[model samples]
Target: MIRDLEDEILGCTRCSRLIDYIRKVAIEKKPKYRNYQYWGKPLPGFGDPNAWLLIVGLAPAAHGGNRTGRVFTGDMSGERVYRALYEIGLSSSPKSESRYDLVELKGVYLTNAVKCAPPKNKPNKEEIGSCSYFLKKEIESLPKLKVILTLGRIAFDTTTNILGIDGKFSHMAIYSTNRLTVVASYHPSQQNFVSGRLTWGNWISIFYKIKTLYTSHNA
Candidate 1:
């Protein structure tokens, strides 16, 4: 079931604008990544299949996930994510630089609101609505999912809308759906990290809270 959904997600071409943008970015190549061959396609969510926790982000970064072929890989946001997970004993590595890396998530699944990278790091309402179908399917496929951690306001809003819930996004806020506990946090974007909006201490603490929530639920 999961594999089928993943295949469909990978081959998705629902958004013409996004597909064209990723391909264009891939070919043009950033000065820093000129020699690198970008993945330049839709990304699939991945991690422990049996996870009770699901972490959601906005979408793939143009040069990050879109290039590396793994969500949150090859970016500053990814660095904080994997480092926090590793410190919490949920990931095998403190960093995820490539899709080939030995990074393994123990009890979490990671995905995004949109599977493909969008221009200016923002996907419009129509695109987000269309992509949420795949995201919803993923949530249904995770039998053990009891908690969802949404990074940033966009991610938080998308997830809640998918689950048919109504809640405003707030950093470190917690909400509950009929079948899942939802937590929202500030995205670990470069600005958030550099501007002191999302500190390392708070970032790590979010994971710790998730760790505690799932542990208690399982207990």
Candidate 2:
């Protein structure tokens, strides 16, 4: 059933603009990846089905996830995230270069607000609304989800809107309810990392907090 949902997401063409852009980029190919075949489709969330930690990212990077077909794969942001997860024993490997890289997530599921890679890494309000259905479906499928760790303000706001919650977004903010918890963190994008806004220590601190919450909750 999960795989079926993934297929559906991959085949989606709700956003015509995004579809055309992805296809064009895939056909042209980046100079460095000319020999590589691009996935060029909407990406689906990947991880343990019964995950306790649900990570929501803003969107797939144009040349990263769009080329690799896996959310957060083949990107610097992905490297940072996967490395942090591995250090904390949440993933089998510290890198996610491709879908077949054998990097396995333990208790965490990673997804995006918009499955398709958007132009300029920014999705319009309408595009985000169009993709909300998939996000909702993905969340519903995670039966054991306990913590929603949103990377960046866009992800945090989108997720909160979906959950019908109101909270301020900050690098280490945590908003808990009777049912689940929502944690906010700065995205590990090149802009953030290069600008020194989201350092390695800052990135790991978010996961450490999530790990603590997950362990205590499951215990």
Question: CA lDDT, every prediction?
Answer: 0.91, 0.88
Stretches of candidate 1 exceeding 4 Å from the true structure: none
Pairs that collide, model 2: none
Per-residue lDDT tens digits of candidate 1, residues 1-219? 666888999899999999999999999989999999899999999898888889999999999999999888989998888898889888999898888888899888899999999999999999999999998998999988999999999889988988888899999889887689999999999999899998898889998898888877778
The predictions' CA RMSDs to the true structure, in order, are 0.9, 1.1
Give the Cα error of residue 208 in candidate 2, in Å: 0.7
Q: Which consecutive 10 residues in model 2 have the weakest lDDT in total?
A: 1-10
- Best candidate according to TM-score: 1
Predicted candidate 2 versus true structure: per-residue lDDT over 78-174, tens digit per residue: 8898999899998999889898788889988999999989999989999999898888788788888899999999899888888888888998898
Q: What is the Å distance of residue 35 in model 2 from its true position?
A: 0.4
Worst-scoring 10-residue span by lDDT in model 1: 210-219
